[model samples]
Target: MAELQFREAIKQAIDEEMESDENVFIMGEEVAEYNGAYKVTEGLLDKYGFRRVIDTPISELGFAGIGVGAAMNGLRPIVEFMTFNFAVLAADQIINHASKARYMLGGQVSTPIVFRGANASAGQLGATHSVAYDSMYAMFPGLKVIYTSEPEDAKGLLKSAIRDDDPVLFMESEQMYGLKGEVTEEEDFTIPIGKGKIKREGDDVTVVATGKMYHIAQNAAKELAKDGVECEIIDPRTIKPLDIEMIIESIKKTNRCVVVDESHPFGGLASEVGFLIQREAFDYLDAPVQRVTLPDVNAPFSKPLFDLWLPDAKNVVEAVNTVTYRK
Candidate 1:
């Protein structure tokens, strides 16, 4: 195992995949000459040359469409949106064309493309820029949604996303790029999609968290441990095709659940997970499932207001306590 920052793990994944597969290439604004918006593609332009490491105009829709076409024609393209907030401009291509091509054509064609970038609020980024699109994209069929929280998971899952024969929406966090974690040095490392990992083991309550929210859940778990509450934290690395079975297994052991998500409360990942827990593990549950998520309002730009709006460890701790019926 090797320690790598979250961004470095992502870069290593792309580097390894592109090195082995000539069909693999990457394109997005500032991806080449500018070394990527977050420097995740730094040095890739020189390593792979302009043909494979490409930079395009500031048009998300145009380049995204090109990426879909390239994938349909046999090239595996990784399309980066500076931030998913900007990807809203290209939703027509991603949701309509790329996602439907395989199904509508009766599996005659495979859109083996990966669309990735930072997602959700990164500090004071206001309403429009802070929207978490994980649940939104996961709702559509023919698309795979992977939101990673750890460096190792980011590296392994991305490699799988690139190799998948379907469209994948990979969501990362702007604030977590600097996070460091141990990643495997194994060659061709790839984690299977739709598999959830138990980050921490416990028996008192099951805490399901994803992306940046996983860290918040971790902090909450640590605090709860002081009062004898043990939380088994499960990170659903893939949002769509959720690993509900693993979650159900955890719930059977714990009999309580608290889902922490960065998305808003209504129609969010937490909503779906909470529903599934009640449906599949209803008999095992000892209490109602609780959720810690952004309220039903746009992100606030004001620092204090944003802090209030954002769900944090305190919020997760409260939710966990609620599910566990603790004071």
Candidate 2:
């Protein structure tokens, strides 16, 4: 294993995939000439050249449709959105074409594409730039959504997504690009989609988190540990084909659950998890499932207001305390 930043791990995965498959190519704004909005594609243009690591104009719809066409014609395309907020403009291609092409064409075409970019809050980006649209995208039938938290998971899952036959919505965090963690140096490491990992094991309560919120859950678990509240933290690395079984197993063990997600409270990942828990493991639950999520309103521009608006360790700890009956 080698210590690598989250962005570095992603770069390695894309580089390795492009090296292995001639059909695999990456395209998006600033990807080729400017590296990437987050620099995840830094040095990739030089390594892969302009033909493979192509850059497009600032037209999400136009380029996204081009990617769908490429995927339909046998190429595997990785379309980076800069941020998923811009993906709204490409909804027609993503939802109507890229996702439904196989079914629409009676299996004559396959959209082996990965639409990836930063998600959720990234330090005062305001409402337009800070939405976590994973749950919304998960509503579509053909798309596989992944919200990775760590460097290792990011690398492995990205490699898998690039190779998958279906369209995958790969969401990252602008805040976590520089976070460092140990990642495997293997040339072909891949993590299965729809698998969750238990980051911390404890019997007191189960905390399910994804993406940036997973880090908050870890910090909250540590603080709760000091207070004699042993919290088990599970990262549902993939959001759409959620690893509900892992979460159910952890919930069965702990008998209490607190789901944390960066999305809005209504129709968020936490809501889906909470609903699934009650349905699949209701008898095992000792208390009602709690959720920690962003407020229902738009993301605030003010620092203090944004801090209050976004979900954090404090919110998680409080939810855990309430479920544990320590409040």
Clashing pairs in 2: none
Could you list the CA RMSD of all candidates, in the order they appear?
A: 0.7, 0.7
The local distance difference test score of model 2 is 0.94
Tens-digit per-residue lDDT, 77-145, candidate 1: 999999999999999999999999998999899999999999999988789999999999999999999
The runs of at least 3 residues in candidate 2 whose Cα sits more than 4 Å from the true structure, single-residue gaps closed, are: none
Instruction: State model 1's lDDT.
Output: 0.95
Clashes of each: 0, 0
lDDT of 2 by residue, 247-272 (tens): 99998899999999898889888889
- Single out the weakest 10-residue window by summed lDDT for candidate 2: 118-127
**lDDT accuracy of residue 254 in candidate 2:** 97
Worst 10 residues of 1 by lDDT: 318-327
